[model samples]
Structure formats: structure tokens, C-alpha cells
Target: METNMTLYHGSNIDFEKISLDKAKDKRDFGRGFYTTTIREQAKEWAEILNYRSRRDGCFLYEFTFEKTDNLHIKSFNGITEEWLNFIVENRLKGGVQHSFDVVIGPVANDRTVNTIGLYLSGDYFLDEALRRLEYFKLNDQVSLHTEKALSYLKFIRKYTWTA
Candidate 1:
């Protein structure tokens, strides 16, 4: 189906209002994007609320959760810095598109008492493509296109954020 792809330049508040359930529904209809675990989904929602990127262009952030054993605040702080560095190095090689427009942090979260989070961001372009893909009538073609887009995004996120 033909689509008029529009850039998603809405406010973080608007993104925060995006229901996870609705996103899941879109995923279902689209049938390609993986559904993240509940914990990860919650954290994504949190990021949407707390997003603080400069308002100039489109960007994507990857949030990583790691379980830790130490409870010392100092140790956790140190780890957070290391994690940020790791994400930064990885993002550099991720081949993110210029259209991505922003590269933000991997806002950490405490998943459990011992767990920590590391979030990373860069550019993203597939969101608009996915939105357009939603109009395609052929389910198989839609699935293929969505999967390809997801794979490309994942590759960029993974390689860009890792050393």
C-alpha cells in the first residue's frame, strides 16, 4: 500500500502517552516487531516520560538491563559510567542514518535491588517506514518489510552501541 510517511516529531509527553498495549497491537497487526518483556516495556515507557534529547531531529535509544550483586551506591555509580562508555563506543560504529537526528543515553533503571540499566540512543528511520507499512494489504509482504526494518534497526543499535 502507498503511504504518506510523516516524521514523528511529537513531544516526549505524547510518546509517553502511547500505550504499550497499543504498541503491542500495532506489532500484532504488523506481525514482525518483537514484543519486549514486560520489565523492558515498562522501562521503555519510563524513558518516554523521562526523555531529554535536544529537540532538533529523530533519534532512537537502546536501554540495557543488567543484574548486579553489589548494593553499594558508589559501585553502582562506577558501573553506570562504564556502561555509558560502552554504549557510546558501540553507537559510533552502528552506522546510524543521518535521518536518525539524535543519539541519547541509555537511561539506567534499577530493575531489581541488584539489577541496573544502561540505555543508549542514536538515529532511527524505520519508525516512519513501519507506520507506512501498516497500510499494506498483503500480510506476508507487510511481515517481510517489517522484519527487514526491525533487523536493520537492531543491527544498527547493536553494533553502534558495542565496541
Candidate 2:
């Protein structure tokens, strides 16, 4: 099942860059068009995550271990819930949706296990959403990818004005 969450931002922006002149051209049929806006956003998010990772120095990794160790004991757990709430509250506003699946497994040493998951979310503005999600994998560093997707969704949310 696909889960949807909306991130609310307070303004509108032009996210669709395809020109009618170009779109109407018969030769353009089946030809793929590209947009760099989301790419830029993803880059921004990646940088943020990278910086945090560098500073935390395996904090994310350790958190994963802790969560796995106490999986059965549920009650306002560790960074997982904190991360989820952070993403949901801050990143996921203005009609932007984020969906992700949790994964747990063993790391280098057989004695210890690692727990991590991919957070999948994107905007409705472009066709690249599903492509991006499909390309992502567990343990893959995709802060930028997710960020760009979210940015695009924010772009879409802005134009879908109801007021």
C-alpha cells in the first residue's frame, strides 16, 4: 500500500518548465524532458544529511543498533520515532508526501546487527517520483534524492491553491 503525507508551504511557484511550443512539437513525442529544480533541492538535503552524519560520526548507525535491540519494547522509542516525527513535522508540510519502509539486518560483524530504512516520498508534479523511489535502496545514502523529491512536491503544492 502507498502511504501519502502532505507538507504545507505558504506560497506558489512555477514548477512545470515544459513550454507549450516545445511540448506541441510532433518530434518531441516520446522524448524525455528534464527538470533541474528538484535535483537542486535534493542536493541541498544531501548536504545537510552529510554534514549531520559527519558530525554525529556513526550516531545514525548506533541509533539503528539500539532500535533493533529494543524492538519489542515500544513506548516513545529512540531516534527512529524522533526522526519520523522530525520528517513528518518539518520536511513534510504543504501537501508534500513522504513514504518509507523500515529494514533491519546484520552488518560487518556477524555478532551485531544493523537496522535502517529508506524514507520514500515525493511530489506529484513530475513523473520522476516513482522512478526515484524505485531506484532507492536500503542503506543507500539518498538524502539528496528524497530532498529533491520533497522540493518538487512543495512546488506542486504551491500551485494547487485552494484559497
Candidate 3:
């Protein structure tokens, strides 16, 4: 990993100056600075945020994280039983938190949400869920889970949302 890697976060709020103190609970990765390496995914997220939460245009904020040597990071290769279980635990716990500074993995976006529900709700087996989820190539999810992780971030720029 590079010492400085660019990460993009798309949101309805202005992150020019951010405060994670107000981050909501029960998030997919549990109230962290969620970002993606893929720009188009962020673009889609910006539109979604604009449509669902804000009247104003969605803002795309760029940040650089010193990923190589600065923090304790956990990387999940792809969607698997281990990844699914961890995500489910964090989401269901809602208030429960993790000690990891950062977590990098596939984002359980809208497409996977239903499938995740089925697996979690006992509607599908692990193999069955993996078979279904494999149809869609998952996008990356980068979660800055702790304040220490935030300290390593440098805000880059803000972009206007375009549908």
C-alpha cells in the first residue's frame, strides 16, 4: 500500500470540516468515515445521498490516508462468511464498536442489502448467498473506524455531484 492513498467519500453534508461525533449508529461498518477507491461508486453515492437526504447537491469529498505505515488496518479480501459475519455483527450491535483503526473491504451497497438480509434472517446458506452475491462484482469500502485513523487523513477537495 502507498503511504498516501487517495480516498473518496460522497455525502449530502459538507465535509469541508468534519466531525464524526455526530455519526449515526447501525451503519454497515458502524459510524466511520466510509470511502471508496472507485470514483464512480462515490458518484453514485453522491446522487443517492442527494436524493434521499439533502435538498442541496451531494458533495464529494476527497481525503488522503497514510495507509502504508501509520495505522493498524484490517483488509478483507472480498465478500465471504467471515466478512459477512463481521459486518452483520457490527450492524446489528449498532452501539457496539471495534478496536480496529481502519477496515478495508467490499461495500455492502443497496444491491447486496437484500441478500445480506436473507442470509442473516436464515433464508439462505453461506454457499447459496455467496453464489448470489458473486453475480455482482462488489465495490470497495474503506472505513476509518477510529479517531486515530482520522488523524492520518488530509482533506483534499470537494466535488459537485453530477447525475
Tell me each candidate's TM-score: 0.19, 0.18, 0.91
| Winning model by TM-score | 3
lDDT of the structure predicted as candidate 1: 0.26
Query: In terms of TM-score, how similar is model 2 to the real structure?
Result: 0.18
User: What is the lDDT for 43 in model 2?
Assistant: 38
**Per-residue accuracy of model 3 over 111-133 as CA lDDT, tens digit each:** 89899899989999999988888
Candidate 2 global lDDT = 0.24
Q: Which prediction has more favorable lDDT, 2 or 3?
A: 3
- Displacement of the residue 115 alpha carbon in candidate 2, Å: 25
Error of 2 at 129 (Å): 1.0
How are the candidates ranked when ordered by TM-score, highest leading?
A: 3, 1, 2
Rank by lDDT, highest first.
3, 1, 2
Off by over 4 Å in 3: 161-163
Error of 3 at 110 (Å): 1.2
Best by lDDT: 3
